[model samples]
Target: MAIEWPTTQLEKQSDDPMVILNPKTWSHYHSYGGWGKFFDGLRERKLLATRCSNSDCGEKRLWLPPRCECPDCWHETQWVEAPQTGRIYTWSVVKYPGELFKLPAGTPLISVEIEGVCTKLMSFLKEGTPEIGMAVKAVFNVDNPTNSILDLAWVPA
Candidate 1:
């Protein structure tokens, strides 16, 4: 004899976190005060960095994530445009997306060392398999951008 399952639903809370929230407002905000120039560079399809302008500090390291002060000498920094080309210092492929991130599996995250910059930049790769020490170039999302760091990605040079 075949058995018919009960048509009943349980109205109970489980261990799973609330997957969605509605009737709520969300927005992206940023002062971009110290970093406004950097984002402005992106809008123009250029890469910019900051470096110490102090004369005594022999180190002229270019910082990718521009800083207001030099880490070595604590001197004030100035803006400088960086070349678009660089090499993959190292990278990782995310096989799964995070709860807040909507990326497909196997997406590549890379640390790029620009040609004349001292610091390495963390960015995503657009296509192809990632390899260490491989030359790459920056690709800007000129048409549309969310103003997030996702506006820029890399590709093989």
Candidate 2:
């Protein structure tokens, strides 16, 4: 099913027959260094991260699933394989009905805090209460013919 972000107010239906909808093309920022390499890893059913260049900084960024930019220091990023799991720092259950169908019914979207890192990454919670500080693991799906970063779901570790 097609997904639609709901409009706040009712509107008259369009009568123009020639009206066309332009689908948004998914894109990655190539100008951001090392982003594609991380995407390639996701396509291969793996998770990757970026580590800060300065040893003293020692900050690690996790998720696919992410671009090369440091949300914190905005420094040049170096690639590394992330541990397959972490813990949920915060989460909210998406109980309200919506236009999106790819998401399962009553699903909870989770934001995880990577162990030993001072950052959080978002993913779908698979099972159990998404309490803060609960252990979680990154799981991959490679058997599917079509997959993206969404194919990497998270469950309790």
Candidate 3:
């Protein structure tokens, strides 16, 4: 069997029949800086964070929603993998779902404290009622990662 390849050089064309795209696409973007590593971790199903990079900062552990600088010493931070397991720090039911995270009405949004991280990460509960300090684990939307933090949820561990 023979395979065929395009021979003609392609050029930018406003009316190319083969090229279709959203006519008025809308998108949101952010300059994530040090937190940029978080998305890379998402693609690999890992939870990453950052810790104080300056020795003078004296912060020996990682922090979630990774800070660009240390809160204590104001030093730059380094990326680290936070434990995917945690317990609910708190939760609230959203009556109206946001367009980005289209959860059912009354779906619980949880703040989880992953092991080894000093910050509480906000995510939706996969199911079941949430209780204070309820054990949970990070669940990645592997099939449909929206490239947003909303792609991560929590379920009973």
Candidate 4:
């Protein structure tokens, strides 16, 4: 008896190199672990940051992409509410994004510099044009959360 194989044909896009588009559909289960609180805060319309717990640590600044542990002293970090408003430290217009990008092309990606935060937070600009020193405020998707970093965005303040 002969073994039966899948008969579904893949759509070919290129003829020279024989590039074919393989259709795929599946659910991906992911866990944020310690970073769960950051997403949770987005649901509540709040920006959560992390700081080194050790008082003696020289780096006394908040981390926007909340670090689980201090990179300097390797000490545990604690969650803290970060400033919702910040200035655009830098930005770039993404004309062509990756396959998994949630936003459309031409979206302005920005790095926000919040007060007291040691590092900049990378997020997308939801409205208006982006400038190097433009003031922006955090906007959350509280009504219908995606439970991902997409839930957080920024807009002109």
lDDT of each: 0.85, 0.68, 0.80, 0.93
Per-residue C-alpha lDDT of model 2 across residues 65-131, encoded as one tens digit per residue: 5547665677766777777778887888877757744777678788877765545778888777788
Query: Candidate 4, residues 30-141: lDDT per residue as tens digits?
Result: 8888889999989999899999999889986799899889999999999999999999999999998999898899999999999999888999999999999999999998
TM-scores for every candidate against the unseen true structure: 0.78, 0.63, 0.73, 0.84
Instruction: Judging by lDDT, tell me the better candidate of 1 and 3.
Output: 1
| TM-score of candidate 4 on Cα atoms, chains taken together | 0.84
Q: List the residue pairs that clash in candidate 3.
A: none
For candidate 2, which ten residues in a row score worst on lDDT?
A: 56-65
Q: What local lDDT does model 3 show for residue 81?
A: 80
**Global Cα lDDT for candidate 2:** 0.68
Residue-level error in angstroms, candidate 3, position 39: 1.7
Tell me the spans in candidate 4 whose CA falls farther than 4 Å from its real position.
Answer: 1-27
Model number with the top TM-score = 4
Ranking by lDDT: 4, 1, 3, 2
The alpha-carbon deviation from the true structure for residue 94 of candidate 4, after best TM-score superposition, in angstroms, is 1.0
Q: In model 3, which runs have C-alpha deviations exceeding 4 angstroms?
A: 1-28, 98-101
The model with the greatest lDDT is: 4
Per-residue accuracy of model 1 over 6-52 as CA lDDT, tens digit each: 76544445448634433445886758887877887897898889889
